[model samples]
Target: MQDFYIFAKNFHINKAIIRRDGYIYQSLIAFFMTGTGNSYTVARWCAQVAETTGIGSQLVQIKAGEKRGAVPSRSLAVFTYPTHGFTAPWLIMKYIWCLPNGRNLHAIVLPTRAGIRIKGAFFPGLEGTAGYLIAFLLWLRGYHVQGVMGVDMPSNWTALHWGLSKQNAAVIIEMAQSKVKGMLQTVLAGNKHYDGMVQLLVGIALAKVSLMYLIMAQFILAKLFFASDKCNGCSLCQSICPKKALKMVGRQGRPYWTFSCDSCMACMNYCPQKAIEVSPFIITLFYYIATVPVFAYAMSYAAGGDALQWGISLGLGFGIQYGYTLAAIALAYGLLHVALGSRIIRAIAAKLSHTHYFRRYQASNVSLKDIHLHK
Candidate 1:
């Protein structure tokens, strides 16, 4: 990969022409959609910047469960996607793997993450490396990776954490737009950048652990998802599913997720009626109750003959500790949900839907060179 970068740098310095001519080579911007539409927002911003700056680009929206198609040859390619479990979505990686090699192609990556802010202090919600991973994959496929830019977007994982309110989300969007504009300006200036070593290390560690967790825990916990009487049989969840994991079943037309679910929580978050409910605390309690005793027994047996005693002791200790934590959190959230949280979230969602937040970037495919020349 280092050698590829060196070669790419020399090639660009000696022979490659960076120009505003749209006909010279194609530029492709591909992105994967999730419930919160964060990645979609970043992709649109990138396209707007590229076009406004006289770089022609095209948009490719990748849907879930779709088979890989031929990769289009291009001089520049920008990849954008949301982070899942502190890493790139597995589906996005698969798409990268299927892309045909782009010899001497220049690439940029924009990965959107949901970070938490407490008392004006920001903490990354996930170990973000989706951009880096995509860049590395592109490099392996003979593309000259320009940079990996991480954009912090509003939190969408309401199941595990509180989501941003409408006002807070608006603030975040404005800040992100400003940051993206600066980054794009640097890229258009032919400069190069990379993430810090610490971030890369953290991303690597999280990716490893997250992969295991996804395989072992996600499907089991997904069983907790259920639609209430409020579900109106709209089938919006089924239609929007990228993986085609959801199917409207029964006469009542409730959405049922299959094993193919990536657990992106799009269905749960976007449900209009607030019908689909997934209690993360309850899932946590169930997970510990089901697995803690077995794990404790195994560890105790490996240590000595008092396996039963050790197992019972360890199980009780962990169970009580985790149980108490989850219970308190659940109680607080339940009260908040009943009192105000539900209404607030629904209002925000309604605002977002009415504004067509996901569709705002529909004009991203316009040729920047034409626009510039026309002006």
Candidate 2:
């Protein structure tokens, strides 16, 4: 099983979505993430929920080159994959594109990401937005849509470190079922609010901006400071990369990241070289600082902004919002990073040739990208 997790919260539940074609349309598209297997686990639960609710559900296992036009209509399309860097896998995007008139169709996106540094929820719901865009395109072709939600899974790398518990799994299944049920009801109620362009635009804008920032983070900030000298260029990073962004290209035979990187940190995390250093200390500092505030904003939204009881600090709220504004200043830089980070990292390496410990290990022709799995 791959990239599987559970959502155990009690939520509003709907039973089914009967398409105009007279078929209860429900579909699950999953890309099991490596190391954790949360994708597969979550997918199973989704299928189970669809069964329990008596909804017509279909499961599609999407690989690198799977076709999408073959999928039947009036169905719930569920996507389960791991986050590469901070975004969903390219394969997922490809699959979405393969869907005929994808934008106009409603889809449920469930991504299994690096649950170590953060929860899967730490992500800004880019996958859901992907579904929204797909649904929007499909809608233009006469397909209607529902909304998106998420479920977090535990990982050895994350705060949990411990493996998922059976109780946890049970809760996640029940909650997921409820949410799916609720979403189905919303679909049947003739509610058309979640069926338009605003959702699409917002989703696209956010994903675009995030991708831009991620690129910048990797190239400008990450590569400028870190060198893959230790990299023997064994291409282990290339092998594990769900995006196939990293390829062996250097004169020394080390894997170099191309523009296709999603920044899920698979290379960095799994780098045998340990040569990939995300540094300047300032960048990490900046990232964490920025992350905290951004997380706060997400929390605020989750709390319903003004509707919830939680209140923002009087003096700090304005500052935080302003701080977020400052962070937005990095968006241009982020875009630039994505545009040139890989090239710049390599170019600088060409200019300087100082060998260090991190370099020799990477150059050793051994698998240094070993993961320390937690029980």
Candidate 3:
């Protein structure tokens, strides 16, 4: 009876050791590739949740577009990026492609967007399947996509729309925090959730040829940006550009936009003085009229002196028209700068402040300390 009792106690102790060892082995190491702008906040929140819930240890965070060392196969990877024009930014895609394929890797994709209310229903700020697309791409590269989620962040694109007020933004941030907590719970349970299928399909429909053309147009439109005398030669816009497309040159220390710009609008949105402005509507309209017909004729002539093919014609025509429009606008603005100088340009920009040409609204600056405190 004594021998049997001692064996039983030893067996229970061995079982407990085995269970603890298994738990330690199964704890996942997570890597988060955080996108720029508001995406940093979302990624930080995810890391915090993982640490608090004990779902993952050895968490690593890498900024989108930044270099990273080799990632291990037995790990969890989280990708977080801000949506641009209802799609993931190109910089995020570049990072995804660079990740080495691994059969045992698990992936979670989180896309942050500005929440918009349609009618009485609040649409989670996701415009399309930006999250699912990332998951699908990772799956293609041999990672098991555990989940995809959208987190509603305060909108920062004040160029096309007004930014959320401080009070409203605070409300949205709280709501997002709650949503993220629930998402982490589901993730820890080893379940999958994707809430943007319809948005995904719509995003796919819009992302094909039209998306390419729009990207090309943005490159051209970037040339239309000009700074007023209020610039103060601070070089803030130049420093903040992800693409390094803006250069501060000449004795006046003015910004010069190069062709390398991707039109992410980081410079304009983050400008403290709102000194950058685009050309007026009348000038843009005149440019389009002047260049479109000529490009259309040239494209038709190039196509064997026959009617241009629809796809080829559309692409070439729009590309040339946009390219010339931007060049002309820039040249005209440059000439004006040379003729009247910075003082006159500043006055003109101020006068056109109420016009649709200038981006009048500015996004509120993000406080890093506030984000850390939230954690």
Model 3: per-residue lDDT, tens digit, 209-273?
43753465545555656677777789977866666678886677877777666555667766778
Tens-place lDDT digits, model 1, residues 192-232: 66654576678787776667555544554444455555678
Q: What TM-score, over all chains together, does every model reach? A: 0.69, 0.46, 0.74
What tens-digit string does per-residue lDDT give for candidate 2 at 275-353? Answer: 5543333354455544556545545543544533445443456466555644553553344334324655644543442
The candidate 3 region of ten consecutive residues with least summed lDDT is: 5-14
- All models, RMSD in angstroms: 10.4, 14.6, 10.1
Candidate 2 backbone overlaps, count: 49
lDDT against the true structure, each candidate: 0.59, 0.45, 0.59
The regions of model 1 sitting more than 4 angstroms off are 1-28, 67-74, 118-121, 280-285, 288-375
Reference-based lDDT, residue 132, model 1: 78
Query: Which candidate ranks first by TM-score, i.e. highest?
Result: 3
Off by over 4 Å in 3: 1-36, 55-65, 117-126, 208-210, 278-291, 302-341, 354-375
- How many steric clashes between backbone atoms does each model show? 1, 49, 0
